[model samples]
Target: MSETIYERLGGEDAIAAVVDRFYERLLEDDRVAHFFEDVDMRRQRAHQTQFLSSVAGGPVEYSGEDMQSAHDHLDITPSDFDVIATHLAETLVEFEVEEADRAAVMEAVAGYEDDVVTVAAD
Candidate 1:
C-alpha cells in the first residue's frame, strides 16, 4: 500500500489549517454564504477540520454525522457544490500544495458529492 494521501497533506495540523481558511472564505463568499447562514461557524469549522482530516486518512477520527445525513435537508444544488469545490481548490493552491496532491484532494471530495450534495440529476 502507498502512503495515504492524508500524510502527503501534512497530517492533522495541515488539514486543520486548510479547513479553517476554507470556511473563512466560504463565510465571505456571496455564492455560498446562504448555506451557512443558520450555522454556528465555530462548530462548523471544527467539524469540517475533523471531516477533512479523516478523509485525508489522518489519525484523527471524525464522529460527526455522515455527509448525507448532515446535509440532507439543506437542498444543496450542483452549483452550490461547485462553489465549495472551487473554494477548496483555491485554498489548496494558496497553501502551495503540489498539483498531484491537490488532485488527490479533489478526487477525495468527489466521493462525498453524492452524500453532501443531492441534485435532482443525481
Candidate 2:
C-alpha cells in the first residue's frame, strides 16, 4: 500500500513546521494579511495544523468550526483564496515537498474552496 500523505509529509512535526511557514507567508502578503488582523495566531496555527493533519490522512481530527461557518464572515474573494493557495504551494516548495505530494495537497485544499470563499450578498 502507498504511504498516506501525512506519512509522506513526515507526520505531525513536519506539518506543524509547514503550517508555521505558511502562516508567515500569509501574514506577509497584503492580499491576505487583513483577514488575520484580529486573529489569535497561536490558536489559528493549532487549528490549521490539525486541519491539515486530518486532510493529509493523519490520526488527528480537526475540531474547529466547519469551513463555511468559520469563514463566512470574512468576505473572502476568489482572488484571496487563490493567493492563499499560492502561499501554500510556495510553502510546500520551501519545505521541499515532492511535486506529486504537493499537487495532492493542493488538490485536497482546493476541494474546500466552495466552503471557504464567501460571496457578498447582493
- Candidate 2 deviant stretches above 4 angstroms: 120-122
| Clashing residue pairs in candidate 2 (N, C-alpha, C atoms within 3 angstroms) | none
Please give the distance, in angstroms, between residue 18's alpha carbon in candidate 1 and its true position after superposition: 1.1
Of candidate 2, the 10-residue stretch with the lowest lDDT total is 113-122
Q: Can you give the lDDT of residue 119 in candidate 1?
A: 67
The per-prediction CA RMSD against the true structure, in angstroms, equals: 1.9, 1.8
Candidate 1's TM-score reads: 0.89
lDDT winner among the candidates? 2
Residue 34 of model 2 has an lDDT of 98
What is each predicted model's overall lDDT from 0 to 1? 0.86, 0.94
Which lDDT tens digits does candidate 1 get at residues 1-122? 78776788888888889989998899899988888999988899889888888777878798999889999998888889988999999999999988988888789888889898876642
Candidate 1 deviant stretches above 4 angstroms: 1-3
For all predicted structures, in order, the TM-scores are 0.89, 0.95
